[model samples]
Target: MSDTTAYSKKTMRVLLYLQQGELTEHQIYSFLASRVKDEQNSSVLRRIAGEELGHAKIWQKLTEKEVKTNRIKFWFYSLMALILGYTFVLKKMEKGEDKATKAYRSLITEVPQAKQISEDEDRHEQQLLAMLDEERLQYVGSMVLGLSDALVELSGTLAGLTFALQNTRLIALSGLITGISATLSMASSEYLSAKNSGDKNAVKSSMYTGIAYLFTVTFMVLPYLLLESYAVALGIMLVVVIIIIMFFTYYTSVAKDLPFGKRFFEMALISLSVAAISFVIGILVKRFLGIDI
Candidate 1:
C-alpha cells in the first residue's frame, strides 16, 4: 500500500539473512577445534564457543510469526532468509537512517515514524561499526577468513607438534599433511557457505577464506623446515600463529563490523576449545599407540 508498508514487508525477509550469517559464522571455530590439538588452540576454541552462540543470538530476535512463516519452507529457508535479511533489511535500515537525517522539514512532519526509526537504526549501525578498528582487523569475507582459518589452525598444530618433536623431516611432513587437508576442507566449506552470501562481497569473502586457509597453513609450516629443531620451529610458529589469529579476530570484527575486543575474546575461546580437543586426542593416541618419538 504505502512505502512504509512495503519496506516493512520486505524487512521480514531481510532479517532472515542476518540471522543466517550469525548462525553459520558460529561454525568455523568448532570445525577447526575438531582439527587442532594443544592448549593454545583449545583456549582459542573455548573463547570462540561463547562468541558463536552470542553472534547467533544477535539477530535471533524474531517474533513468533516470523519463525512460523519461516518454518514452512524448513529446508534452506533459514539460509535464504539470512541472505535476504542482511541485504535488504540491514541495508534499508541504513538507508532509512540516512534519509531520516536529511529529511526535509515538511516531510519530517508527515513521516515522523520513519524519521525516528531511521535515526535509531543509524545509531545502531554506527554502534556496530564503532566497535572495532578496521586497520588492525582482518577482512572477514570468505577469502580473508578462509585464510585466517588455515593460518591459525595449521600454525597452532604445527607449533605444538614441533614443540614435541626433534626431527626436521617429521616436522615438515606433519605440516605438509595437515596443510593440504586444511586447504581443501576449508575451501569446500567456504564455498558451500557462500550459498548464504549472494552479494559479490560474499563471493569474494569465500575466496578470501580459502586463500587465508592456504596461507595460514603454509606460513607456519614453512618455518619448521628452515629452523631444523622442533622447539625453535614451534616457537616461531607460535608467535606467528598468535599474530595471525589476532589479526583474524580484528578482521572479523572490522569486516563483519563488530567490536575488536568482543571478537578477540570469542576467537580466543574457540581456539582453546580446538586445542583442548587436540590435546585429548594426543593423550589418547600416546597412551594407546605407545609411540615415543
Candidate 2:
C-alpha cells in the first residue's frame, strides 16, 4: 500500500504537522550549535539537531511529503537565544516539544514509530537539562536577593516619602539617596555571604546582586523625577514595581523550571504589603508632627 493510502486525511495532516515541527527544531538547534561558544554544549546541540532531522525524515516517509522548516520560528528562537542565553531558549523549545510528545503518544496505534518518537522527545528534554550550564542562571540567587530587596525597600520608602513630603523633587532626591546607600550595603553583604560560603564566583555574584538592585531602584524613582505630582508618581512607581516583579519572576521561573504563579504572587504580596504599611505610617507621622513641606 502507498504511504498516503495507509492513513486517513486527518492522520496525514497530523504527520505533516509533526514533520514540520521536527524540521523547524532541527534548524533551530543547528543554528544554535553553530553560534554556541562552549564546545560541549555545541556538541550536544549538534547531536540533538541530527536526531530532530532523523525524526522529521521518519515522519516524511509516513506522510510522503517534504516539509519546510518554519523560518519565522527558527529566527525567533535564534534571536531569543542571542538575547536571553542558549539555555533559556533551548528550555523554551523543549516546552514546545512537550505538547508534541503528547500528540505522538496519541498516534501510537496509528503509527508504530510514534511511541519511539515520543520517547526520543522525552530524552531530548533530559539531555538538554543535564547539559545546560549558563553563568546567568548560576547567579540567579544573587539577582533575586538584590531585585527582591530593592523592590520591597524602595517601594516602601518612596510610598512613605510621597505621603510625608508630598513633593516629587524631595521624594526623588530622598529615594535616590536611599537607593544608592542600600545598593552598596546589599552588594557588600552579598560579597561577604558568598565569601563565607566559599563560593569561587563571590565577586561576580555580588556584582550581579548590586546591579539588579540598582536597576530596580532606577525604574522605581524615574516617575518621581519626571513628574511633579507626588501621588501620581507614587502610583506610577507602584506599577513599575509590579512590572519588575512580574518580569524578573518570569525569567527566573522559566530558566530554573520553577512555578511562576506562586513566586510572582508571593513577591508581589510582600512588596505591596510593605508599601501599604509604610504609606499609613507616613501619614500618621506627618499628622502627629504637624510637618508640612
Candidate 3:
C-alpha cells in the first residue's frame, strides 16, 4: 500500500517500518561487524536477527491473520534494498573506517558501544570491514611499518648526532645524509623483504611508502636549514619530523583501509621497535668503538 494508505491502514503498518528499520540496521551491522569481528558483536547482530524473526510474531499477534503475499513483497523489497544498500554502504563504510582509524584510540574510548552491536548491525559491519580489510592488507604491507620504523630510526640518529656536533650546516648535512641513506636502505630492505612475500601489492606499497617517507624526512630536515643553533634546530626538527610522519602514517592508513585499533598498534609497534633497535645500536657503537656518547 502507498504510504498515505499505509498511515490509515492499521497498527500493522508498524511491521513495514519495523522491517525497513531492521534492514537498515542489518546493513549497518554488516559494516560494523566486518570492522570488528568478534563473538560479542556477532552475538549482537544475531540477537537483532532474532528480533527480526520475532517481528513476524508481533505481526501475528496484532493482525491475527496471514499476509503471506505482503510479506513476500516485503522480503523482495528488503532483499533488493540490501543489494543496493550494501554496494553504497560498502564504499562509504570503508571511508568511514579510515576516518575512524584516525581517532581509533579515542574512538574506542569514546564509543563504549563500539565493541557492542546487535546481530543485524554486526552483519552489516562485518561485511564492510571485510571489504575494507581486503583492501587494507594490500595497502598495509610490512613496508608501511618499515617506513615508519625508518622515520624513528633516522630521526633519532640525526637528532643525537646533531646534538653532539652543534653545528647547523653539519647538522643539516647530517640529516640529509641520514635521510637519503636511510631512505634508500630502508626502502630497499623493505622492497626485498616484501618481495619474498606473495602480496601482489607489496612492491607498489613499499615504493610509495618509501617516497612518502623521503618527503617526510625533507620536512624534518628543513628546520636545520632555517635555524642557527644546531642543538635547538635538532630539537625543533624532532618535533616537526614526528608530526609529519604521523600525518603520513594516518593518511596512509586512510588510503589502505586499515582499522582504527589495528592501525594505531601497528604504527606504534613498528616505530618503537625501530627506535629501540637504533638506540641499542647507538649504545653498542659507544661501548665498542668509543664513539662520542
TM-score leader: 2
Which parts of model 3 have CA positions greater than 4 angstroms off? Answer: 1-126, 133-137, 198-202, 245-293
Whole-model Cα lDDT of every candidate shown, in order:
0.52, 0.90, 0.54
Q: After superposition, how far is residue 20 of candidate 3 from its true place, in Å?
A: 18
Ranked by TM-score from best down, the candidates are 2, 3, 1
> What order do you get sorting by lDDT, best first?
2, 3, 1
**How does model 3 fare in lDDT?**
0.54
Model 3, position 20, has a per-residue lDDT of 44
Q: Across residues 117-194, which tens digit of lDDT does each residue of candidate 2 receive?
A: 788667765776678677788999999999999999999999999999999999999999999999999999999999
Looking at model 3, how many pairs of residues clash?
22
Clashes of 2: 0
Error of 1 at 171 (Å): 2.4
Cα lDDT tens digits for candidate 3, 124-160: 5456345433333444545455556556766676655
Q: Give a tens-digit lDDT track for model 1, residues 173-222.
A: 98889888877777777666665655444445555666767777777776
Clashes of each: 53, 0, 22
